[model samples]
Target chain A: MTRVETQDRRQQAPRRSLTRRLWRAAPPGLRQPLGLVAALVAAAWLVICLIGPVIAPHDPLAQELPRFTPPGEIAFLGTDELGRDLLSRILAGARVTIGLSLLLVCLSMLIGSVLGLLAGFFGRWVDETIMRFTDLVLAFPTVILAMVTAAALGASLFNAVLAALVVSWPPYARVVRSIVLGLRGNDFVFSGRLLGFSAARSIRVDILPNTLGPTLVLASLDIGTAALLLSGLSFLGLGAKPPTPEWGSMVSAAVSHFDKWWLGVFPGLAILTVVMSFNFIGDALRDALDPGVERR
Target chain B: MSGRAPVIAARDLEVTYPGHPPVHAVRGVSFELFRGEVVGLVGESGCGKSTIAKVLTGLVRPAAGEVEYHGRPVRPLGVGRRPLAQTGIQMVFQDPGSSLNPRRPVGAQIQDGLDLAAKRARRSGRRSGAGPVGEPPADPANVRRVIGQPADAAVSPTAARLLPAGSPGRWLERVGLEAADQSRYPRSFSGGQRQRIATARALAAEPDVLIGDEPISALDASTQAKVAYLMSRLALSQGAVLLFISHDLSVVRLIADRLLVMWAGRIVESGPTEAVWSNPGHPYTKVLLGAIPAPDGAGRLPLVPPSAAAFDAPPVIHAP
Candidate 1:
């Protein structure tokens, strides 16, 4: 059982380790403007999420003395209508917004991957039942589905996560199902099946490896979608509620005091920045993982 | 005949997967199998040679037909389910790397069959007392988890196949491989070497029938010959039936004992290798036989003309 285990362990490394190495050793072709932009944006998002609360000058929720205090020594991103430091609030909420979106993405992938493995690997009744169920869930727009689920689960971050997980898992399941459907009857799969691999086991073990390139691409793309959903939910006052320093909730709170442009501008920029970072990362990952795939 | 049952006998075999406008992959492909007989299935790509292999190996279900083992009909198996009857029939695929689980360790994948055989032997071996059917106590799921089984329920019958109880090193040796090479991934080894590993795996299963679906097609010309020789030799020594499917007429000409020539999913000719090679009665076989390049000193052999115009287009590159 231990044969070549050490070698395999070394081969199967952390993605972050790989990305870090890429950053450290930027290849000659990779040292371009766009690559630099994408890498920095992705790395910055990770750093911001990791160290957001520690370095900010003021409490994100603490109000400043004056509203609309344009970029000054005291405040970096100016002041909101409530006189809160825009920079501080943006910094503070990075953890909650990015963290929750990522969590939702992981949860969705877990559910979708398992469901996809079952549906694809076992394509009779199990395939039909899972596909029909996913389609039923996909019948509604993600926002609408999240809205319904959140309303039922009650308005909270956890509930918003539930909504996102429920709404987003189907796309992954559908993609994986399609990949499985294509590869299940292939010669290699037949060999695996003949070697005594059961349907579920063959999908997970044999089929999933070859299919993970697309699955990873789908999961990466879903991170941005999940973030947008999180922000939208918060903007509607269903996520994180208020005063907990969420970008979406801040935008929602900013709406009440329409006179102040800084409130809307700062939170809006924060949401855009985080979402754009993930979108850029997804594109970069797709290219790095499959150089053969032309990004039209 | 040593009074032993035939390794496999598929009668009136048919395979049809409903596609857009419906496609008939294999239609009424019937053949009898015997222990230690190497039956060569020759046809062009998409001619359903692989499909017949899938059907015989229990990887694909026949829409209509009777598949029998030892003169008895066997049930169909699917993705998540495999019948006990099929555990003894193993397959070696063309793409060696893909057949192996990339996420798993190499030894574990080979051990998968060994473990399964061991477990099954435990159940049946106790009653029959076949001197411990496998070397050691092995579990299929334990092997499967290493091959990326679901997080829950580590090993299940649906997860992986188990090899026998102990010492896979010997199995490696039997396949003409050294013990040092057992731990390497399929990617790490050359194509010929991987095929050897695949052969070792099939041997570990101790299958009644070894199905080779173009197992040598993916290898280099020289390597293909070596692997083919190894497979036939090992198959004979193990006393297992070798069902070799290939599109390479020359390869089959060298390796097969009995030949079954197929086209458009149905067999056109079936008989002894020498009979089919020297006197191919079927027009299709005759055309194919004429196409094979001859040895030096032989005069310029003329190309065979196609019987039908449609057949000329997308011509068979290598017809067995």
Candidate 2:
């Protein structure tokens, strides 16, 4: 039956074809102008987070300008009551606020998704143990539980993240568990088992890929909420310590200087833009990953 | 007949699913499949056809009786161990579209069978601490190197097509597809082509018994015959016992050498395909035969009156 079949002669694609394919398959919501703009803004913030301190105009901690200087050549966004450059402080805070949020989301999603896959696939006692724990965590109001955990862990950025992570992962477990429950019944998964694949192999190779879209959509939507919660903890002084340039602490510090409106307004605007941009991106992801959308 | 032990034997099998009231899915079903024979298991909906397929492949443990492969009792699947029956008996599922992993290329999906076979060989080789007589040599220390060996040089010719690096493309060709098509995803293939890929994957493992449970049910009428023909032909050519299960009698009649008719979780009639078609001994079989719509319009459609007696009657066994 051997023929001199010429080996696959299909022209090699450009090296970045994988990237192109991902771009093509991206949800229509992400491709739309609103989603694109939101993505651009989010990308800009992420860049600022990575290299914020270096690019910031002045020493964020330096009270060099005179107190309460209005927007001028000397102080662009104006100086806070402490005479620190508001632009420099907001720029420096972006790293702690956004980076911590992304970290919390990733950690929670990883822990929760793995637990959900195990609970859904193994189901009997495993399901009971995981779901009951998830319920216990979910029963508490999210911010309150995070606040209590943060307070208990002491005042610091790292402990705040740990508290947020503890509260945030339950929703992921619930969502991923339901998705896995539906997918575990698919014939491909059963066929994998029939083909002598181990339970772990079947779950990873056959079932995991199917759950990615929904899980990803959920993760994207949670980024902004994660940021807000972390900021909230910091605002309560149970998070970042004084002079750390965290947005929530900056806003809290401004309360003492109520007459200086710019003290409150700049950091507030920073939080709003970051949160709104993430929300827009999350909405687009949900639309893109919707089953009714043409993924091909 | 070969006068040898049956490849797969199910003796008085019963499967009861637990629910509010227990559903006796398969009640005292028995059958034997011989090498190189195509057996058609025909039945109406809800007659426990799929349940029997599951039982035979050891997916669902029968509450009573046993499934024996080559006279050895097939063990129930235990945690962390490969299913004993899986190495010898592979199944082609109902829906071709869903039977394949949509995210993977057809080539990698086919490669799974070959890789599994290599893994099984390595396991046995290690247990025996040497290559058993007439078995493939213990896989090279590097499995990838063994897979890269030429198909004919890798193992026995019977298993050559299952070499992970060597024969995915060849197996695709055996199922009437281009070797180049292996890289394509399941969605790109038509229903018939996907079923053929399913057949190729199952056959690649060099199983002794192949169970196709309504393998063409999701396909169009035109594609159904082609896929059904391809399956029986390829399975026979490989000398595997092909237990072809389906509800449509016409397709079964075209390929099956022997026929087993099932009703309400029991095999009601058994005989050669032609013998059962010509002279159905059971009333239920007659009703089933009559229900097939005659496209030429020569005979009127037969109406089946509700009869408890027909369902409960003893099975009619016919000599081959």
Best by DockQ: 2
Error of 2 at A108 (Å): 0.4
List candidate 1 stretches off by more than 4 Å: A1-33, A63-68, A148-154, A255-261, A291-296, B1-4, B15-30, B43-48, B63-65, B95-97, B126-184, B188-191, B263-270, B279-284, B297-320
Cα lDDT of candidate 2 equals: 0.82
Model 1's CAPRI class is acceptable
The candidate scoring highest on TM-score is: 2
lDDT of 1 by residue, A56-173 (tens): 8888787754877777776877787667788888888888988998899888888898788778877789999999999899898879889888988899999999887889899889
- Over the stretch A232-254, how does candidate 2's per-residue lDDT look in tens digits? 99999988897889998888888
| lDDT (Cα atoms) of all candidates against the true structure | 0.72, 0.82
Candidate 2, superposed: residue stretches over 4 Å from native? A1-26, B123-166, B297-302
lDDT of 2 by residue, B1-320 (tens): 54777889999999999997999989999988887788999998889999999888777889999999888887776445456445768999998768888888998888878776666667666322121212222432101111222322312234333423336887777676777788999989988888888888887776768999999888887777677766776666556789999999987887788899999999999988889999999988988888888888577867574399887777988788
Per-residue lDDT for B84-188 in model 1, tens only?
656778888888656665555556667766766666677666422133332221322111111221222211223222332344555555455555556776667
TM-score of every candidate: 0.79, 0.88
For every candidate, give the share of true A-B contacts it also has: 0.56, 0.54
